[model samples]
Target: MAKQGYHHGNLRQALVEAALGLIEAQGPQGFTLSEAAKSAGVTPAAVYRHFAGRDDLIAECALQGFRIFGDLMNHAWNDGRPSALLAFEATGRAYLAFARRFPGHYMAMFESGLSPSVTPDLAAAAARAQGVLTRAAAALCDHLPEGRRPPASMISAHVWAMSHGVVELFARGAPGARGPYPPEDLLEAGIGIYLRGLGLIPADTAPDPSAGTAPDTAPADPAA
Candidate 1:
C-alpha cells in the first residue's frame, strides 16, 4: 500500500524509520535502499537524496544506535556516585537493557558487517559508546592494588564480552528456555564473579542492588 499524505519534509526521517523496521525483520543485508524507500512511501530515487546507498543508510542506523547506547550507559553510570563498583555494575545492566529493548539497533551497532573505518561519523559514535564502558571499567579498578589493576581497555573488553555473550545466549529468547533467572540477574552474577576473579573487589563482596535499577525501556530516538 502506498503511504498517504507523505511530505518531502518527512521523507528522510521516514526512510530511516523504514530501514530500521526492515533491519529488525531481516538482517542488515536482507534489505535494499529501494525497499527502504518503498516502505517510506517514497520512490526508490528519493533514498539517494538522504543516503548515498545501502551502506550509508546502515552506517547512519549504526551511528544512531551507538549514540542511544552511550546515553543509556552514561545515565546509568551517574558519575560513579555512592560507589564506583555499584555504578560500574549499573552500566553493565544498562548494556543488557539496551540490547533487550532495541535488538535491531543493537545488532546494527555490533553485528552489522560495516566497519568503523567506513564512516567517520560511525567511528566517532562507536568510540563515544565504548568510552562509557571504559570509564566504568576504570572506576571499578579503583579498589584494585595499583600493580594488579588491569588496563581500562582490557577490563572494558572483558566485561563487554561477558555481557554480550550472556545476552546472545540466554536473553534474546531461545525456544523452550526455562530458566528461573532473568537476564539482569545472570549479568550481575557474572560481573560480580569476574570482578572478584580480577581481585578488583573482595571475594566475599555481594552485588549491590542500591546502585541503580536498569532504566525502563524508552522509545527509540533515531535523531542521532
Candidate 2:
C-alpha cells in the first residue's frame, strides 16, 4: 500500500505510467483496474476520478502511445530532406526502433484491441504518424508519370504494412528467432523492391545502392 498522506498532483500520469508497466509485465488483457490502482500507489476510487473504467484507462494508454509513436516517426522523417528516398528509409528504421525501445507502449498501441471509433485520440495520433509515410510516398511517386503513379494511400499502406511486418518478425525479440539481416536492412530491401514494382523508381536509373546508408545532414526543423 502507498504511504499515508501521499499527494500525487499528477495522479493521472502516475496511473498511466503504472498501467504501462502492468501492460508490459502482462499483456494488455492481463491486469485489472484495482491492480492498476495498487501499482499506481493510489486507491481504486482515485483511479475513477481520472478514468471512467478499465477500458477508459486502457484507451488513454493507447492514445498516449500513439502520440509518442507519432512524434518519433515524425522526427525520424525529418521532413523528407537530403532526399525523400533516404528519409523514407529512416522512417522505417524508426518504426523498428520504437518497437524495440518502447515494447510496452508499442504493444498497447497496436495490440490493445481498442478501435478508433472507441478512441478518437488514438485514431488521430495514428493518422498523424502515418501521414509522414504518406508524404514520403507522395515524394517518391513524384518521379513517376502522372498516369503511372500509384495512389499515395496505396503506397503508404504498403510501406506501413511492410515496415510493421519486418519489425514484428525481426525486432520483437522472440526467443531463438533470428533473421538473415537486421530489421532495418530487411525493411530497406523490401521498400526498394516495392518502389520498383510501383514504377516509382525507374529500373533503368541505377539505384543509389547506398541510399539507406546516407548521412542525415538536413537542416533541423521539428515541423518537418
Candidate 3:
C-alpha cells in the first residue's frame, strides 16, 4: 500500500500530468516512481495513492498519450482542408509532427508493455482517431470504382502503416552514410504513393522530372 501524505490535494491529477511530462521527455523506461513523486513534490509513497505502481502509472500515461493523439487528428479534421487527399496528408503530417514534438508520448502510444491492453478510454481515443481516417478513406472511395470500396479499408490500414513506419524509421536515424532524405519530403512522397494506390490521383502527378524543360509524357509504367 502506498503511504499517503496528510495533504494530497489534487495529487492524482498532478501525478498524472507530471508523469506525462516525464514520459514526453524521457521514454517510458526512463521514469521511476520515486522520480515522479519528487517531480510532483510529494513523497514516493504518495504516488501509489493514485496509481497502483510503475506499470499502472505507465499505463495511465500511455492512455493519455492516445487521447492526445486523438485530439491531434480531430484538430486536423476541423481545419476544413478541401481535398480528401489533402486532408489525409494533413493528418499524416499531424501524426509525424506530434511524434517529433512529444517523442516519449509517441512511443508510449505504441509501446505495448507499458499499457499492453487498451483501457476503455484509450480504446475510444484510438477509435476516434481511426474514424477520422476512415471517413477520409470513404471520401476517397467515392472517387474510386464500386469494385474498389471494399479494398479501401485495406488501403486505409496501409496508409497508416506506411506513415507510422516512415516516421519511426526517420526518428531512429540511418545505419550508415549521411541521411539524404528530408522528413517532410519523405512524408509527402509516402502520402503521394498511397494516394496513387487509392486512385485519388494519377501516379504520374509526381513533380515534373525534366526540370520544366520536357513536355508531359505518359508514365513509363502504364499499369500504374
Candidate 4:
C-alpha cells in the first residue's frame, strides 16, 4: 500500500535525502526500493517517477555527493591562498571533514559499488572533485627539484588514499574510533612525512602544515 499523508516541496530531493539516511544507517545494498519509497512517505511505485530503479536513485545521491565534494575541495584549496603548503594541507583536512559530516554521501560516493562512470555527469563531478586536489599537488610540486618531481597525479592519489584510510580507520563515530591519534593529527603528520621525503618542507622541523593556526582550530574541517 502507498503511504498517504506525506507532502514535499521537492519530491525527488525528498526521496534522495530520505534514501541517504537509510544508506547511512543500513549501507547501500541494505535497503530496498520499497524502503526508500516508504522512507520518503510514498509508494514503492513512486520511486520510478524519479528513478529507473534503486541503482539509479543511488547514482543520483552519489552525483549530488560529488558536486558537494567538489565544492568543498575548491573552497579548501581557496586558489592556493595563505601559501601553497597551507592550502594543500587544508584540502587534506577537508577530506576527513567531509567524511565525518556526510557519511551517507561519502559511502555513496566511494563504497556504494556504483561506478561513477555510470553516467557522464557523475564521472565529470567525481573528476572535478579529484582535480582540485591534483591541482593543489601540482602547485606544491613546484617547490621541488624539477629533475625528480613525481607526477602530481601520483602525489594527490597518495594523499587521497591516506585521508580515506584515516577516515575509515579513525575519524568516524564515537571516541577512539581506531588508533590513539586523532585523524587530523595522523593525516597532518603523515602528509608531512610524505612531503619531507620529497624534500618539500624543511626536514628537521616538525611537520606543522598550518603553523599559523592552533592544531584543533585549523580551518579545514567545516562544521557538521
Question: lDDT of each prediction vs. the true structure?
Answer: 0.80, 0.78, 0.68, 0.85
Candidate 4 lDDT over 170-210, as tens digits, reads: 88795356789888989999998898787666655334676
Q: For residues 174-221, could you state the per-residue lDDT of candidate 1 as single tens digits?
A: 421535677788888898788778777666533457856644443221
Can you tell me which runs of candidate 3 are displaced by over 4 Å?
A: 1-8, 24-26, 112-116, 171-178, 205-224
User: Residue by residue across 99-177, what tens digits does model 2's lDDT show?
Assistant: 8888778878777787755866778888898898898888877766788878998989988889778877887786215
Best-performing candidate as measured by lDDT: 4
Q: List clashing residue pairs in candidate 3.
A: none
* Candidate 3 local distance difference test against the native: 0.68
Residue by residue across 31-74, what tens digits does model 3's lDDT show? 89888888777889878778888777777766777778878986
| lDDT of residue 150 for candidate 1 | 89
User: Which scores better on TM-score, 3 or 4?
Assistant: 4
TM-score for each prediction?
0.85, 0.83, 0.78, 0.87
- Is 2 or 4 the stronger prediction by TM-score? 4
* Best first by lDDT, ranked: 4, 1, 2, 3
**Which number leads on TM-score?**
4
Q: With candidate 1 superimposed using the best TM-score fit, by how many Å does residue 192's alpha carbon deviate from the native?
A: 0.8
- Per-residue lDDT value at 168 in model 4: 85
What is the Å distance of residue 215 in model 3 from its true position?
6.9
